[model samples]
Target: MMRIRHDQRSNEIPTPAVSFQPESVQMAVMKEKLTDQEAVVAIGQQDVRVRFVDGVPSDRSFMVRLVKQEGGTWVAQAVPLSSIGRFVPASLDDGIDLWLSARGIRLTEKEKEAVRRFWETEGGSIKQKQETVAALTAKQLEVTETHLRLAHEALHGPPLGDLLAPLLTKTEEPEETDEAKGVPVREQTERWEGSRAYAAASELVLPPAETRTFVMTAVTEKMRQLVHDFRVWQRDMARQLEQFSHAVAQQATERATPLVESLIHSLDRMLLNGDWLLFTDMKTETKLLEAGAKLAEAKRGLAEGKMDEAAKTVREVKALLESLRFQPSEQKVMRFFLESDERQGMKPHEQLSRILKQASQAARDNALSARGVVESLRRLGFFHEQEAARALLSGERLPPAENVKAMLLSWVEEGTAPAQAERVLMNLTGQQLLNKFTADSHTQTMLYQWPLSLHGEMATVHVHVNARSGNGQLDWQNCRLYFLLDTNQGKVGISLQAIERQLSVTVETESEKLAAVLQSYASTVKDHLEQIGYRVQRLVFQPMDTEDEERAATDRIKTENETSQWEWTI
Candidate 1:
């Protein structure tokens, strides 16, 4: 519970009057004051004047409770710093007990412990903590009430109403009418007919044989359209150059014409040779876009009669295009996807390692965000389409689906580029395929996979949960959770199994050096799990042998019944 104080003796303090606005808590920084009792404080983005009911704190900052008054004024009450530490309990279980007890609901010791352990191993964050707490509290209340009722019945026997009920005259059963019986039969027939019609309709809609082939063909067509747009833009630029002075036109042509021609030639060769995948690197796409923007700037300068500016802009454009002449290779594209940007001040391995650690914690703490990622990709695709449409309407050409698709694939695979509609659609289709395969397997395993972008690099995380199900409800108490992380530093896997509130964890990696690094943090991980209230039965860091990689891959595909032991190996 929270306490608020109102001091009538302090005239400087605003009276605590009720307002329509809800109460809120915020942190505030105390500033130097005009008087002993009056001082200014920074609360969020606003500077507020507050009068202390008690003496003002000597400390620089503290948490404050703010309440709105009827006159639209805010009254601030400083929370004692000492009391703030008590907000989070020393143990998660203790916290759960306290909350339940506060609600006038009491549970047996075993029941209380069970509730506490559920909170520890559950997959949720602070954002959903209260909801989980409320649900658990309600469950305990129901269980306790049931026990009490059972005890009452055992001691007192059946109720007086139950004894009197049997003494009353029996009521005659009513026979079902023909219409009632026919109604159900008719409904059953209609349902069967409707389902049959739906099945027929579904069979008529033939899906693509190979989604990859469909995607490749669509991308190739988009690339061709982009090339056509580029040619039109080139002709428009040539025409615009004529508007400039003769000297400026000659200088611009000398600088820009060769570079533009070279770029178009490269694109033409790639499109004709069916080697667009070689050009999927986001850096190359960005350079190409930058070159276009410079050309547009040059055109604007020429139109404004700034011949010197236009010539300089053309020179910049020439330099940018010259940088794009490097030979594209599979290795180079993979490197582009894996490498972190130098400007971000972190190596690829370091950035990925950090992301992996955060991901491990998030796997236990947060709800899976795979669906959110798909939604984001959809939104981004729509945005890119709108941008392209606007550009077309304005007679300014934006690069076509080739560049957009390249960017989107880069984003999906490496989390480096923007999302495009084609890639989003392709991913959505892939998701459907994944669902089909998973359903066909008839397994009680839940899987979620998503890409995480950090410090200009991307890491993919895959989570698998195996649990028991009865009465169509999953039993999380006896469940196994596996997290697989793929990053520049290599793959790291974590496996957690919880049974009756006891948790065992195994962390595995292929590289011995990486395993050694994670070894130092093993205890920290265990402590964190324990802090959440579950007993840490075992925590192990086992590095896999390089030679065993093939064997490990074979073991992973074994059916649940065939695989006697679950191993977390990367």
Candidate 2:
């Protein structure tokens, strides 16, 4: 007889007690039955104990594995039939390939083999796999969110096309004539005027007179608010200046007296007819800020008992106040602000390249810390560099692509310029979508949409880089780079491909004048490439229409694939 113990806590059967039988009887039974005889077993959800007797069949039975315990007794424990199969480790490499493919990224056979070996070398634990999946999902979600936000903005905000329509070249419309309209010229003109009036009237339920009155009221209220704010700011500044002048030396106070009198004069004029409000241009604001800074400097100098220094700063402040009094016309200021010409005569890429070169030299010379590097790059207007530095400082070992996106998100949280941040966010979304559609695992591709200030205008340059790697390392010699931007001249597309240090370049533009200009600089471009250890094999200018741009890109990619051993699809 054998006794079975049930676990009180779990209501699960414990290991069956060892059954002792005579050796001769066991041998005889084993000889008669080549395999172990299965015994009927029934287990309820709450019950755990199993009873064994001489041959009573049941629906379910436990497959027991017998092992000899201490002395001569044998122990029986239930073994699962499912666990008897040959063990095969989970294939994380396969999972990764499937995931990439699902996101529209195709891997070459060689790339697949490399990835498989990489996975084998760097074992993928369950935790690692989970983290990888989570990270990718989060990136996808972020891209989706960016796209949704952009869509919302496009739907709700003023149409960008409408804003740009005036700048774009317009086709001449055929002049309308009375003859064409089958009416007399005077009557035709009257009918057109009446139709315009009718259309205008149809737009609003209120009459034209009422609409005009409403607009006038709104304008008056807005002007009143602006005047009030200006008066408050002027009063506060004047009070502060008075206090500062009192705390300074006699010479400083004498110089500050003119500034205080000027502010009081402006306030008095504003009180009379609000004529002083008309002079509130950006230049005036700048001068006022400079005077405030000078006042602070004078105060600091007075605190330190430097009478001469305080007087000098006060004199500078007086000069700034004089300049503010002779401020330029509002029209001139508006024209200056509207000017969008490229003063430096350099493309966005050229400007970026120059800035990067300078930043690199500066970083090396200064031996800048990560945060210092970030600030320096930001000051130099290199957005990518700033984000990269921030990523390194974040202490997360993220890939370059992910690092950029992560830092962009952090910048949003840190309250960076909304326009700049949103531009980057949209750029990232575009890049991800592009990658998804045109992915090549053999050649790593990165897309960057860099916003550059070409003089006064903000120009976005789309940079696409494709680098081929055979041994899981970047091959700079086997790479392609494309830069695309819309300039005042036209849409410009520049493609540079390097195959074993032999470079081929193509500059395409819609404008013939721009094409000619680029062609003239072909030799200079070739020389520059050759100086950088690349033998310039080809340099050509091609005229491409805006409509054919996408087709040209596709054809170029196809041609590249045919010529190169490694596929270059970005």
Candidate 3:
């Protein structure tokens, strides 16, 4: 594998833009912490360039060959995909495919089909086809009437137009259209029920007159085979129609879904860059969504004519999509169940079926059963304490839980939930949660509201720090910290509530002079938690954000003046 290397460090300079394009994907070499001029120069100069933009995997040997064709301008064209980059040219097949898609190329029939179906189901209005069909039907009727009138005129004395007037008139036929509705709703329902019963009886319920048979032409085996094949055909048709809104319209439904997923993911990456990226990506998102709507409309157009497949497919996707909204950290979400036995071990992908498992049922019963709860415990990154807590919670018939509490606590104390799953096998029966007591891997304490009276003698300080190591690594111990302030104090609660908006503080700490100049900076925060009235549940300092280096660069330039404040209040 060829690697892109520079004698100068990227961090010492600037970062490069990793992007996609058509025909020839461009590779750039950039400095990480570069001066503005260096950054500009790196970008301006084709520091490093890799061509052949299409990234999709295929058997085809599509490639791009670049040439400085006599003139100063270097031209690029598609050629067989080959090695590129560094001392030894390395083929970045992944990037190649991505570049292709970025440039609107695709490989793999499944990928193509997926992209097509997604778009069609997701596309725009499909009603025009139905309207066309109706108009055609009306035209045929008019033609038939005209022919009949001409025949009558030839046979008799009346004018052809006059003879055809009855058929040609646009009068509403109440008898033909509303006959079904004339019957009472109940009577109509019963009539359908009776017809269905009779039809069904002809096949299954009706008695067979073997002795009184007049003529037998069809074979019973062939008829049975026909019925079986017809059923399979119906099922397939229904499945296809359900997938596409227009069951009859071909090719249109095939183009939608991939476009949506691809566009959405790309837009997400763009948003990470900055407001400019956001603005750009949002437009792309809107375009992809609109295209998808159009494709869906096309499918819908075909599936009309009393076919319910399209409707079913739409409904099914609609339901499944609801699940997409909540991105849970663990697969064993309370909302869904796992397929694996709760008593046994399970792999992530192999664990459970969200739809087939009894998760919803257990949820209602407050008995969340996943594959041993061990995986979720590991996911939570609770060290040993949380895992120990979960081990008891899992309700396996291990030794008496009261006695085994120590065993679980040992795991939590070590932050070894993943390891715990492997090392010890405690029967489920004995281990359980004692309502009052719980285990913790690490402990933290908060101090708030120190007295002004004890200025130098016993000055109090409030601080947060993680001092416990579950992995037996001292470095890991310092990765977390928090407070356990004034649980019994009244003013602390009020401060906790209001301070969350913004902490206002004035402090004077000595610099060179032990009693002199300290720094006090005023700051504020936007909404962190709107669920007011709840007591400060350990301010879980868990903030989730995706990494966008480009966006960070832009932000750094923007907030150059925002400096940290020094406060005696921890």
Candidate 4:
């Protein structure tokens, strides 16, 4: 293998100065963070040019200008010889081979043998250890950056000055109360539900499914804390603004005024979304709107330096925020559950079936038994264990199933729950909820017999549908169909007596050729049927025919021969 060597450096490759310049200097400055014309020129100049000899570079060179490190050290990066202009390869493949050989990546015969042995022994563990090291390095870098940012903040002050400037400039104008900033409420809810559903259907279904509930509960509590914290913080800010210097007071006022207005504005927007209305009543929404108007008035007063009026308005806003509560909507939650992309082009029944299948697989993966499944549903407050069991056995809907689904979706939005209705659903297996709540259930087997005309002959095909195992392990052998050839293909005597004799006894044949023909036919038929959902379960072949009389005589002769042989030997 050929190796590239630079005379100025040790065994380690020197670090190269990295710069991005996709096009002209002006374009680079605008898009690639090239600060000035000098920077662009520095990056574009090919100060170091490399030439390849045999398979390796004779001298370490680059297409761009190389910037040296503090001690006049430079970084080296592998560049394709094709881009260097001086080195031309025979062909693309030859160039690739040369590149690999130059990098010592292409092994020698002895090295290849050694590698093969290593792979046969410890390749997997070595590869795994390398990945672990890489992951740790990346994590370390991330933590280091976070610590650096924190240190910078502690040394200086918070970066609030930059963030508050734009808002503070518009302090004179009344802030716009209600406009959608992020995703639409409906879309956000859909995305949240879709993510939850996707997680439940993934390889680790039970954990994600259970985790969704836990996360939602945590979010609700967190949001509650946020609202409380913000209100208290605003109250303190309002009090300080009246007593502090104008600069400090002005900044505090700017921050507090917008925060209150934003809180009220977001509340109004959420109320506008019908999903939010499921948890909040019309009376509550109307009250919230009134609070928002008061908050706006307070903001105006604060801006105008009317401290008393602003204080009075802040108190009103705080009271309204306290009065506001969240509750989950049943219909909206159900809709979220039912939502799916039409591009999959599945029927409603099919989609429901798929969801149930995923749930069952999730349960099995989580090591949940039938009784455990029932208990999970009861724990989720979907229904009592007895009720869930009965509902599953009878394929009936549980009474509290809607509420259970609604509670499951409480995490979709902060204000999507009623305190009483949104209870923590612990250890609720997704499969159990699907099995206990849904009316349609998974069937173990389905047999369908149909007559088909094949090769100018009529035959009956029996299709057996074997439901997959709870964990989604498909027993392909058990899920098949059997084709029974009609006995009327070859004609017997046309007389009534002959026909009666033919029909009286079962026709059995000892033919290897027939079995081969039937096997081919079964495969062809199975493939075609499966395209339209009728999958073959198993093929049951008939027993081979034999001559019992001949076999019995042969057995007696063999026994006599064996006895004579034994006597002679003795």
Candidate 5:
């Protein structure tokens, strides 16, 4: 029920006149430019609904004025809420301006004003609220302007009276003489109704030569009646449909039937006649298994001679379970009671179903699951030690080489083969590497963490890193600088870069040959990371062993890594 006013006198003001031609205003500037969308141009009285990109998945709702900038691009500047106006009710942007105006708000200047208002909120915690609001408001304004322009065009004739100007100008309403002014408005509307577009379109079908005043009058009356009847009938049918739908919904609820029941019923037919292979759903499977387990439990109790109790429980459970829509299982457990003697019958449990006979088959299932584990272990190669342990203790299978190597290393450390149960605990190692590393970009520069796991002289890095902090003394041990290799080379340290679980290198070798050797080793390491699908964004060099330099590296590692040369923003 929005009514936009252009001037003081308002007579249920209709659509706004829209024009792209400049009329003291750059009409083109009134147009909106959608960054990734096509512009929608409209004119007068039409409502514009423009969705501003909030960059958030869910956007808050509001209405604002659509204004085009000098560049013919729309910008959302929240207008004073008091200066807002209403749009037509049915329109998308209809009532938007009015709503804003009613609230004494202006959409065109929304970003600037909204930020000011929101900052008053207690503990808001939004640092760049103004910037975010500006971005969103700008996007909304563009869309709003486009819609407003389109609406304007629909009502007013191109505002410049351009294109089709003659027809609009030529058409004029009949003059009301003094005596005719006394007639009711409806009577006047009816008298001239034939002059409307529908009457003209109908007249074109008649034979000009056969046309007469009487015949024309008769035809016009019939046409009016027909249009009236159609409208009335349409209204009645609409009312009936709405009532019937509501009643049907109410009846369904009273009968305690679920909408899913209908869907489930349709599924059987759909499966037989349409696609069935694609019907798998985890939720449906879980429901089916649940129902089956309940049924099995009921049957087990019945077998134990609790007939009455089992019957009541099973009946309620079955009906409740069946009420839910479910995907049928490939196989279902069915228990058949056996008649032991003429005097009595044994229950399902006494007869023993497959699930109940599980103890007799536990060994088989366990073996199958074990085989699956081995296949995966074989593919990974790191589980070989476990496999060998299993074989030695239980005569299962051979272990992989990597697994055996880890086990051997563990045994050397402990100086003895740990107990079966303790072996699993002793081998546990955190992320291991021994080199310079970087932290996540979101972290502060004061502190950073690196993840690493090392055994002997080998460092398995899983991330990219950078090093800085020129020269200073460093306590390598406290800093987790383990797995160091000192061969004629000064010192080679490895560590995991915290951002990505990848290896980093810091070589302190004063020997040129050793440096070259370390670089060669790094090339191999890089290749390994690439093979494992890790992002090798950067590889850097910096001085370690110096206390000040080392401490500096530790403190600013995160920022240094993020700004490193080898790092790509993407």
Candidate 6:
């Protein structure tokens, strides 16, 4: 519908014959070192459907002339839109010259006058517009140029057109002449009826009514039946094409459904068996779970004949899978984590789950009172501290220690955990961790603090419990753990704080050596915690500010040992 005219003749006048070789002009330019003022005109002229306002499509032709500026970058200005129709559309090289000369672009007086004479000879008006009719801004021109380049690339190859020249050249169809229209049936019949042989045959023919009745009842009915059959066949083919389009749209989902289902089932099994934390904050697992849910939605949409929705959902799933941050080595580790049975007996949360169940029942005997519930939360809090420290000591494989360590440290420092695990598994720390942290009553608060040891390292855990509510169910609202780890070089101050029920870790020490050790081992600790369903925040390392470093270390260790008491104080 958007037509580009070569001349200002409206639709009535026939176009003039004009030709320009773009290749010839380009070759000539390549042979010479062109000056800045003597610009080789590059035109991005086209009639396109552009959205000018409110995303409404408008048909407009643009003639942009790009000139090389001081630094070799091209800057463009819009030529009068009417200039596009002044020259032949296929004559791109001539059109560029015409546009430049019309605007008096970088031309000598003699050259400009010669171009003006040629324009006049071609019936072009010398009365140019004071300004470009619909000029685009520089940014808009850049976008237009990019679109033009892409369009050129799509239409023509990067090669010198030699490879596709035959295809590119216009192959004009044969024009239908009036003689080729063929003789009409009425004319042919009239000639036959006027012939002497036709007159002799007419004399032996039946009356007009009898002849008409025979043809209508027999030949005409037969022809009508054939036409109806052909129409039915055409309708059947159209229905098949519609069905085919739906099939194509749904094909990807159909192919991926089995694989996706298998992976989901595998993940479910892994979580159920307590293979909890492969990495701190099972984000990869969570994404896969979400993808599975979306895949289900897509299936439903497809089954209900919502092809567009199904296609869109499938694309989203593809993108998510592609965007997974796993490296090749990490991918292998993930596969091992999913498929290997190495952690069968070492289910990360097995011990924690058993201990919580016992604590829960013991607390329930007292009608789920705040004191009893706080005790359970206290035990759970201390467990994570011990586990994190233990993992640090073991130097466990965490999907690349530094990244995981960094993630955990950020979580710790920012106190921001990723999206909460949906339906935190009741069997593991899910129900226990979320349920046990709360406020002790409205006014009077209940707090639980305890110390834990990991291979001679000392740590303290603090749990703030909410008292019995009107429903009689108690919850722990906040918890924190402070711990220290001794490395070969010095002492590292490691603290894990779980505020608002989210766990985070921090490290502090006077010695840079000890900080490095903690920094290296932090990811291992995070990995272990994550495996155990502990979403740990990032790590924070701060230097001990004391002047007497040895004394400071002694004081820190003594303070931790002094506070290593299993006491429940209100």
Tens digit of lDDT per residue, candidate 1, span 89-171?
44565456445544456677776665555556544444244333443343233333333222222212222122212222233
lDDT of 6 by residue, 1-570 (tens): 999768655656554533223211111111121342233332222111111112211223334433323353334334445544543533433554555544435445554344434344322123221111111110122223322222222112122112112211132223544643442322212221111212222222233565534433442343344344434533443343344345546565464444434443443443332222222124544565555555555655756767677667656665665554321122222222222222234332332333333333332222232233333444334234434566778995433211112333344466652332111111122112222323433322222322222232223232333233422332222433333334445555444544433565545566666666557776776665554344665555556544323322221221222121221111
**lDDT of all the models against the reference?**
0.45, 0.43, 0.27, 0.34, 0.32, 0.36
TM-score, cand. 1 vs. native: 0.26
Off by over 4 Å in 2: 1-423, 426-440, 470-473, 551-570
lDDT of 3 at 59: 26
> On residues 1-570, what C-alpha lDDT tens digit does candidate 5 reach at each position?
999768666557665555432211111112443433333333234433232233111212233344443464333333333333322233323333333334344454543333334434312223233222322332233323322222222221121112211212222323545653443322212322322312332322223433434444553454445345434533443343333234334543322222222323333223222221112233333343333334344444444645444445445444544444322111110000111121123332222221112211222212212222233223222344445676899975553233322443555577664233122222121111111122322211111121111221211111222323212322111122222333334644444342322334344433455555556666666655444324445554433445423433322222233232222121
Arranged by lDDT, best first? 1, 2, 6, 4, 5, 3
Comparison by TM-score, 5 against 6, better one: 6
When sorted by TM-score, best at the front, the candidate numbers are: 2, 1, 6, 4, 5, 3
Candidate 6 global Cα RMSD: 40.2
Q: Which window of 10 residues has the lowest lDDT sum in candidate 1?
A: 555-564
Candidate no. 3 TM-score: 0.15
Per-residue lDDT tens digits for candidate 2, residues 1-570, read: 898777687865576643332110111011122123333232212122222222322224333333334343233443343432222213445345434433444545664554455445433443343232332332343323334333223222222222212222233323545543443222212222111222222222233565545543443344355545555655565465555456454556555555544543443334323433332333354455445445545555655767678767756665555443322233322221212111124443333334333233323322233233333334333354445576689985644322333444655787752344454445444344433322235666554444443443445555666778543444556898787777898888877888867888767677778876777777766765554346788666666555446633322221132222221221
**Highest lDDT scorer:** 1
Model 3, span 1-570: residue lDDT tens: 999787665556655644323233333333232332112112123332322223222322233333322232233443433343221212334443434443334346544343334224322222222122222222232222222222222222222122212221232212422532342322212222111212211222112355112111122232334344434533443354344444223444344343323332332332222112111112222332333333343334434532344344344433332222111111122111111122134322122221112211222222222221222222212223444465679975444221122334444567643332321222111011101111243422211111111211211122222233332222211232221112212101111212212222222222213212111111111111221111222221111112222222111111111122322232
lDDT of 1: 0.45
RMSD of each: 26.3, 24.3, 35.2, 32.9, 41.5, 40.2
Give the local distance difference test score of model 2. 0.43
